[model samples]
Target: MSNKTILITGCSSGIGRVTAKYFQTKGWNVVATVRSNPEAQTELNTLENVLVTGLDVTNENSVSTAISEAIERFGRIDVLLNNAGYGSYGVLEATPEQVIRKQFDVNVIGTLLVTRNVLPYMRRQKSGLIINISSMGGKISFPLGSLYHGSKFAVEGMSEALSFELETIGAGVKIIEPGMINTNFAETVGAAFNVDPTQTEYVAFVSKVMEGLETANSNHSEPILVAETIYEAATDGKRQLRYIAGADAEKIIAARKQLNDDDYMMLIKQNMGL
Candidate 1:
């Protein structure tokens, strides 16, 4: 049983919840933060070594308070997991400005704020790990995924740059790029931003695409796979800057490495039947 203390964000359902439970089972002290999900609160509270807290990642005060509370409870934070993010699925032009702002606010800026707040303690300890949960979309783009892709790309860039900056300081930064994990994330996107047939000419096209995604997501890698990947990243002595979680995720990364811009888009278009 590892005695390392870790803080994780977005622990209501899906990957975050799974990771929290997995870490607790491994004997790690975990501070799991969720944004007011009563059921999730009840479920997480059942864990022995886990501390469940209310956290709205996009809110500055909430972010600060969560970090502070974790520090107070755990004494020190050995790992910080920025896993709170959601997707906005739609064409870039079709996506509202407010929606775009909110997407970036939660997925990109929230990550920045959380990392910024937690870094001081890690820096003082001179030994800590910061893990950002990105998507395979970070490396590859899909149609109707512009807004979602943008946020993940930002995470990828930030993680890469931060990894270089932190390497010399004995701290480590890593990113987990999971591919289409079986989770409620896709359902959330479908519920939050369904394509309006009357609003755009590509409505039918988008609907078909979304249907395909819904099917794919239903049978994708389980949340436990991502949880285990995160656990390995956090505890492994030889650290890597990025760990691709699923087989599909690894394939996406490999494709990104092998294909160029036009070819990649062509492949996506073909696969998605766009």
Candidate 2:
């Protein structure tokens, strides 16, 4: 049994929920948070060494209160998993400004806010780990995912820089890039497509990309894989910076590294039949 505590954001479903349970079973104190929901309370409260709470990562008060509560319950936070986010896919020309802002708000800004609140605790302890859940899209882009990719790209860059700064304080940062998992995240991405019918110029391209996305979703990895990866990252005790979780993510990111910019762009276009 371990006394270490891990605070995870977005525990209502998918990766967040699975990770919370995984950590609890490993005998670590777990703070599992969701965006204020009654059902979430009942669903997660059954676990031992788990504290389920309401936390809207984009809201400062919510982030502050949840961290405080976790500290109060566990006395110390050993890890912080920034997992609260959504996919925002749309053609840039057709995407509304407000939607763009909201995309950054939830994915990028929310991540930053939570990390900022938790850093003081880790800094004082002089030892801690921060694991951010980025996506393969952060490393490689796809058409109609400008907003989603943009935010993830920001996360990758930010995590890399923060790793350097945090090392000075005896803290470390790591990023997890999952390709595609069996979750409602794909459905949410489909629903978030913002192309307007009147914008006929992008229709054919969007349709093809959507088709490619559907085909890719047909072979997604299980959420447990990601949960397991998080556990490994937390326990590996190495100063590793990134862990690509899914098979698809590993292939894609590896390819991206091997190819030059233009070749990679062509490869993506060819794969999508664009």
Candidate 3:
């Protein structure tokens, strides 16, 4: 059994839950966090060498308490996977201020909060890996994805710069930029649409844009693909910065590299039929 340990957030379901289970099966200790403790979590509750804690990353108290609990149980933490995030897709002008704030809070600020708390433990060990879960959307943007894409772009930039700072301390930083993965996150995004009936001026255009988005997401990789990538990111022992997950994710990112801004935007619009 590898004595190595990984601390992951947002484990109630989706990528977080799958990643937690993946590490446990690999003989690594796992600390999985959910927003609140339920009576039971069938998938994660039964796993061995795993600790489930309540953590609301946006809240300082929740973040610190979870870190303390994990350290107390495991003695040390080897990896910190900031996998807690959600998307709120909608028209920019119509989207509520609180909703946009919450989106950034969970995706960007929450990532920093969790990382800030775990850095001390990893620094003390003098060796660690921090993998922030970004998305292909981070590099490529689409209509109604402005809010979601902005947060991911922020994370992508943050991880890149932080890698330089952590290298001197023997700790490493990596980003898992996953494409469309089958998860509840898609359902959440679908539901975040808050259309304004009075503001029907943009309705027809928005509908077309959404149709294009649906086409873009028609084929998505399973969450395990991303979980496996996360596993590789943790164990690879290399300073690789961005590990792209899905096949579409790879293709899109490669295209992004070859195309300039205008071309990329045109390609995205064409692909999505916008």
Candidate 4:
């Protein structure tokens, strides 16, 4: 049994929800937050040592309020998990500017905002961890995944830089790069199809990529695996900055490291049947 506290975002379902329950079961105070409709979260609300709240990571006021509430309830925050992100896949030319901006706003800016808001408390405490839930997409790219991949790549960069500065303050930063967790997040990734039908060439390419993704997604790792990995990163007491969670992610990232850029690009094209 432990008395530490963890604040997680995007707990409406999937990884965030499972992680909240997992930590609570381990006797950690869990602050579970959603973008909206916090009142309807009966399951987490009923759990002991859990605070169910509303936190739109993109909103500064919402971010501040959630942090204040967490500190008030738990006296301190030991871990902050920036897990509130959705994938929007579309070609750069076909994706509307607003959609592209929104993707960065949620996936990149939201992570930054939440992390900034929590840093003060963590710095004051002099010992805390910030875990950003990136994806294998951060390291590699796919067709029509420009929006999603760009944002995740930005997170990867930001986390790496932040990790260096945070170490001096006795705080650590960890990035979880999961390949494909069996969650509705895949549907969210595939739902954004902006390829113009009139552009027959782009449309054909997009179709093939989506088809390949559908087959790849059929074998997804469970969300618990990711949650368990997050727990390890939090307690492992190592200087490791990135934790690859899924088997697929491990293999793919390993291959990415071994191959040169041209070879990797060719492999990606072949995999997508391009």
TM-score per model over all chains? 0.94, 0.98, 0.97, 0.98
In model 1, where is the ten-residue run with the lowest total lDDT? 190-199
lDDT of 1 by residue, 1-274 (tens): 7888999999888999899999999999999999876345887898787888888888889988988998998889999999999899876656678898999999999999999988889888988999999989899877788889999999999999998888776798999999988888877897778455567788778877877676667658999999999999998877678899998888878988999998988887777777
Measure candidate 4: CA RMSD: 0.9
The local lDDT score (0 to 100) that residue 231 gets in candidate 2 is: 97
Model 3 alpha-carbon miss at residue 63, Å = 0.5
Compared to the true structure, candidate 2 yields what TM-score? Answer: 0.98
Using lDDT as the measure, what is the rank order of every candidate, best first? Answer: 2, 4, 3, 1
User: What C-alpha lDDT, on a 0 to 100 scale, does residue 108 get in candidate 3?
Assistant: 93
Residue 259, candidate 1: alpha-carbon lDDT: 90
Lowest lDDT block of 10, candidate 2: 35-44
Indicate whether candidate 1 or candidate 4 has the larger TM-score.
Answer: 4
Write one digit per residue (lDDT tens) for candidate 2, span 1-274. 8899999999988999999999999999999999987255776798888998899988999999999999999999999999999888878888889999989998999999999999999999999999999999899998888889999999999999999999888999999999889988988877777888998988899899988888888879999999999999999998789999999999999999999999999998898899
TM-score between model 1 and native: 0.94
Tell me which of candidates 1 and 2 scores higher on TM-score. 2
Query: Each candidate's lDDT (Cα)?
Result: 0.87, 0.92, 0.89, 0.91
Write the number of the candidate with greater lDDT, choosing between 1 and 3: 3
Comparing 3 and 4 by lDDT, which wins?
Answer: 4
Count clashing residue pairs in model 4: 0
